[model samples]
Target: MGLFSRRRDPESPAEPFQFTVDKVFVVPVRGVVCTGTVTSGTVRVGQAAKITLEDQSRSVTVSRIEAQGKKRSSAAAGEQAGLFLGGLTMADIPTIPGNDGSIKDGDALSGASVVSVF
Candidate 1:
């Protein structure tokens, strides 16, 4: 099946958590923060998740979740929030390709989706 064509089992016990990255920012002391709207299911602080970018994907543990400038234990679909991710840096994000073939541009989280949670 295609990426967007994938669907969840309605009878499943829990809905799969899905989030699309709208923006990524670096905090002075919080490391990398990803801001977006939860598209499906629910996400909790300390939850293990996967971030997929083009042909690459990485495992990430959610350090914290924030909504409306307040700390929250969890967030559900339709909630706009910022998630502090563990072990991710600005360098990990794809950027303009360098002379050494190390840079990759058009690396955005626009259509990225978090379809599941561990």
Candidate 2:
């Protein structure tokens, strides 16, 4: 092995899952759904995560996942998916501190990143 090519430790913790939001949807009774592409690691149904937008954050659970209009149990890096954020409604999503409106339109959530919580 070369000096710069150290072997990965099998016992090491997995990388934290991350997904970048491309859009946001607020379903009347099913909770908020964020559609985007997974940038790293993997996320599964029931997984806990934190959504960070600017300086605001929210803890949520991955209640469900879908891709290509089909239901999915998990999503991995490079895949696009819609993640249902369980327990959150439109009222729970935060807006910029001084902004005048809540994140109602999908465009407001663009570029937000969701990271898995240990």
The candidate that achieves the highest lDDT relative to the unseen native structure: 2
lDDT of 2 by residue, 1-118 (tens): 8889989765434457999999888877778999999999988888889998667788889999999999987888999999998755786555544476544667678899988999
lDDT of 1 by residue, 17-118 (tens): 888888777777788788889998888777778888678788887898999999997889999988888867777666655788765343366566654564
TM-score winner: 2
Pairs that collide in candidate 1 are 95-104, 97-103
RMSD (CA, angstroms), candidate 1 = 12.3
Candidate 2 TM-score over all chains jointly: 0.75
Model 1 misses residue 110 by how many Å?
2.4
Task: List, in order, the clash count of every candidate structure.
Answer: 2, 0
Would you list the C-alpha lDDT of every candidate in the order shown? 0.76, 0.84
Q: Give every collision pair in model 2.
A: none
Ten contiguous residues minimizing lDDT sum, candidate 2: 94-103
Which lDDT value does model 1 have at 107? 31
